[model samples]
Target: MQKLRGALIGCGFFAVNQMHAWNDVEGAVIVAICDRDPERLAAVGDQFGIARRYADAAQMFADGGFDFVDIATTVQSHRALVELAAAHKVPAICQKPFARTLSDAKAMVAACRTASIPLMVHENFRWQPPIQAVRKALDAGAIGEPFWGRFSFRSGFDVFSGQPYLAEGERFIIEDLGIHTLDIARYILGDVKSLTARTLRVNPKIKGEDVATILLDHEAGATSIVDVSYATKLGTEPFPETLVELDGTEGTIRLSQGYRLEINNAAGTTVTDVSPKLLSWASRPWHNIQESVFAIQQHWSERLRDGGETSTSGADNLKTFALVEAAYESAASGSPVEIGALL
Candidate 1:
């Protein structure tokens, strides 16, 4: 198959993993990379062997013969950059926290839809190796019919070291980190029909809530609780680990910390480790995220080759977006929010 030439805009922390994945992906090539910072541009460009580098996305988009553009900039710049990309008729893959707000996200999605171009959100948490392994088991009926589940992430890892901007941001864990965990719940169970959320700004120094508990009612009769926190001091628990508890009609599946898969049913309890292959970027607590970047890139490559669809398409991510809005609203009103009404 032919490789799809692409340009990566934004040479931020997460963008590094994408560059690595793009190298190994069969049907994709990074012909150009753009970053406002010339230092980042030169560094990532040289490392990836991408000769074409630009300080501006428009210049890169105009000059580079790329089939698509990957926008990995901050959430605040997403709408403008994506709008420009859509105007150029370039299919786009945007990093998540789709936009700063629902209206902006709607505009970006609407623009791409009107231009008849594929626009997908890069929501890659569930694609993490061990996470995918759990997803596969659920699909294979190892956990029978799923009825309940929880996705939890807690840690005090210095996430601000690389993305120091996160520490000074207006929004914290929910929109920043919680989005991934919430999307994971939606991925495993299904679209949320209703949700009740409680959020806390445990760390008063920053603006957004650092701790959140979300209760979701999935359309498929599955109930899920997703909790995320960046305030949890790491003593015994490692940095940023998502613990999943899945209860099915006839059995149960517990996937967390390493690759343990426990199945409890009438046939007695059986345990297995069906973790997915780790990516080169995977290490320590960030391994899941690293593996995810690779898997999602491969998923993108496969879709391009086979004319398939991305799991995190703009239309699909609208649901995840609704959950974010509801979380904030619920936090304000101190009550449960119905997700279906948002659509």
Candidate 2:
């Protein structure tokens, strides 16, 4: 099979992982790179040995030879960049928080659909090994018919150090971190019908809420809680780990902090390790997220090659993005927000 040639925009802190994952992915390779900052662009280009580099995205699209464009820039640039790729009839993989607003995300998806080009959101949380294990257990009926679930990620980790801009945003944890947990809830439980949320700005230094607890009512008649906090200081920091507790009609599934998965049903209790592999370029605590980045990117490449829809296509991500909007709205209003109305 011919490998997919990809052009990546944004040479920021996280984009480096995408570049590394692209190298590891079986059927994809980044042929070009773009970033507004010449220094950062050249640094990433040199680090990855990508000679085709650009400071302007428009110019890159104009002279494009790649099969897909990966928009790894921040949320503010997402819609415009995705639309630009759509205009060029190029398949695009956009980094999440899909857009600045749900409306913008819808427009981006519509633009790609109109152009008949594939559009995927880099929602890699569901692709994580532990999370995938939880989903698999549910699928195998080990937890026959999940009715209640809790997806939690509480950490005192200094995420703002690497991405200092995270502290500057008016909408912090819910938009940045809670979004992933929300997507995981949808992935493991099902689509959400309604959401009620409460937010708190525990950290005085940050502009937005550092903590959030959201209640979700799934369309499949399941209830779930997605609670995320960057202000939490635990005995042992589960920095990048998303712990899960799922209760089904027949049993329970627990994905603990140490990558331990436990399932208890009539058949008896079983414990298994679902740790993510540490890639040569990956380090501790972050290896889980790094592995998922490769998993999602590899999925994108395979789907792009096979002419199939991605797990988190732009259209599907609108549902997840809607939950983010509803969380903020519900948090502010102190009421439940209908997910259907937002979508």
Candidate 3:
């Protein structure tokens, strides 16, 4: 198989993990890198042994020599970069919180569709091992007919230390973090029909809400709650772990803290450790996320080569991104937002 050459457009904090993952990927490799910061571009290029580097994305795309472009920049730049990729006829994988707004996301999707380029939003939370385990159980009917579910991500960890920009955002947890939980909810239960949300800013220092609870009515007639917080202080601190509780007609599935997945039904009860593997370049608490970054990238490579639709294609992620928009709209108005109406 011919190797897929990928050019990455962000050389910042999280993009380091992406660089490492791309190295470990079987059929894809990063041949060029672009970032506005010359220092970051040099640093990541040296670390990854990538020789080609560009400070301007426009110049890099004009001189394109890669099969795809990975847009790992923040939300504000996502739409422009994706459109740029579409214009250049390069397949793209963009980092999430898909865009700054639903309208922008829709436009990006439309641009990609018109260009006939494969576009995937890097919503990697659902690719995490434990989360996949929960989905597998539901599909296998370990919990016969899931009727209600909860996806919780609570942590007191100081995420602001590594990414100081997080503290400066006008929209914080729900957009940056809850987006993942909401995507996980859709991935597990199904599509949402309506959603209601309430949000609060527990910490006075931050500009955005630190806590949020979302109630989702799935089109499949299932109800689920997606709650996320950066303010919750637990005994041991389950930072970055997404705990799940699912109730079904004949059984239940629990994805508890410490990556323990338990399923109980008429057949019996089984508990398993569904922890993510720590890759050589990955560290402790972040290993699960790092693993997922690799998994999603590999999936993109396979699908791109095989001409199949990505699991989180731009069209599919529009639904997940809509939930974020709906959450904010519902929270401000104190009413249930109809998903179809927004879509």
What would the per-residue lDDT of candidate 1 be over residues 154-261, giving only the tens digit for each residue? 876777777877778767888888898988898899899888889887776666678999889899998899998888886576555678899998888887665677
C-alpha TM-scores of all predictions: 0.95, 0.99, 0.99
Q: Tell me the deviation in Å of residue 299 in model 1.
A: 1.1
Q: Per-residue lDDT for 1-343 in model 2, tens only? A: 7888999999999999999999999988899999999999989999999999999999999998999999999988998899999999999999999999998999999999999999999999999999999998899999788989999999999999999999999999989989899999999988999999999998999899999999999999999999999989989999999999999999999999899999999999999999999999999989999999999999998999889999999999999999999999999999999988887
RMSD score of candidate 3 (Å): 0.6
RMSD of each: 1.6, 0.6, 0.6
Candidate 3 per-residue lDDT over residues 1-343, each given as its tens digit: 7899999998999999999999999999899999999999999999999999999999999998999999999888999999999999999999998999999999999999999999999999999999999998899878889899999999999999888889998899999999999999999999999999999999899999999999999999999999999999989989889999999999999999999999999889999999999999999899999999999999999999999999999999999999999999999999999999888
Candidate 1: misplaced stretches above 4 Å? 274-278
Which candidate, 1 or 3, would have the higher lDDT against the true structure? 3
TM-score, candidate 1, is 0.95
